[model samples]
Target: MLQKILRIPWIARRTNHNILQELGMKESQLLKNIKQLKLKYFGHVVRHNNLERLCLEGAVEGRRGRGRPRRRWTQDISDWLGFSVREASILSQDRDGFRSAVWEATSYSYKDPP
Candidate 1:
């Protein structure tokens, strides 16, 4: 299921409905599990504001929001899973800020791992 999420492009919270459907998850359950996974592994909560922003920014509209939006794992999640903590740590002093920085760096096509 995680792999499936990773494979999709331009994922956002709004479009995550389909991804959750594809994974056989209810909206509430999906959000619960995502939060659980994030906290368990990253030791931090996935902010609701961030989730909303991710949905808005990452969504791929089929026809200017008329059709279902395409979903992909948020760049933050993608980079977090792909990049090492040490690399993220060196990027910013604040934990959340570092994560954001790493995500932005990777999202903008920076190839360096750190």
Candidate 2:
């Protein structure tokens, strides 16, 4: 069910409604599950304001005259990570290699606590 939603490029509120209709589950229930999963895997970072803005911007777009843009479920990291893993595997030799590359690209390093 989650996989189905992740496959869509831009899942709107209406798309969720149709999905819920087909699955015989309430939208609220699905949302609750997503929230729970996010909390369990992502911790409080999922609730940060920056993440919220990124999610809203990535997931939705407003029409020229529409009231507001709708959030696309695919914008969420959980949804995108599935695809990212596959792409990462194809582009790199190993996870450690990818991590090193990322550190080099971003010029970021971790220091041990004193």
Q: Count the backbone clashes (under 3 Å) in each candidate.
A: 4, 1
Cα lDDT tens digits for candidate 2, 1-114: 543545654534446566667768776555545644542333223334576535533523564556775654434543524435335333344545544433343332454222
- The collision pairs in model 1 are 11-71, 11-72, 12-55, 13-55
Question: Tens digit of lDDT per residue, candidate 1, span 1-114?
Answer: 554546764444446666667778666555545644552334232323456445434546565655675553444454544555434333334567655544443342533222
Quote each prediction's TM-score.
0.23, 0.27
Where's the lowest-lDDT run of ten residues in candidate 2? 39-48
Give the Å error, residue 58, model 1: 34
Off by more than 4 A, model 1 = 1-4, 11-14, 34-114
Against the reference, the lDDT scores of all candidates come to 0.47, 0.45
The deviation in Å at residue 2 for candidate 2 is 6.2
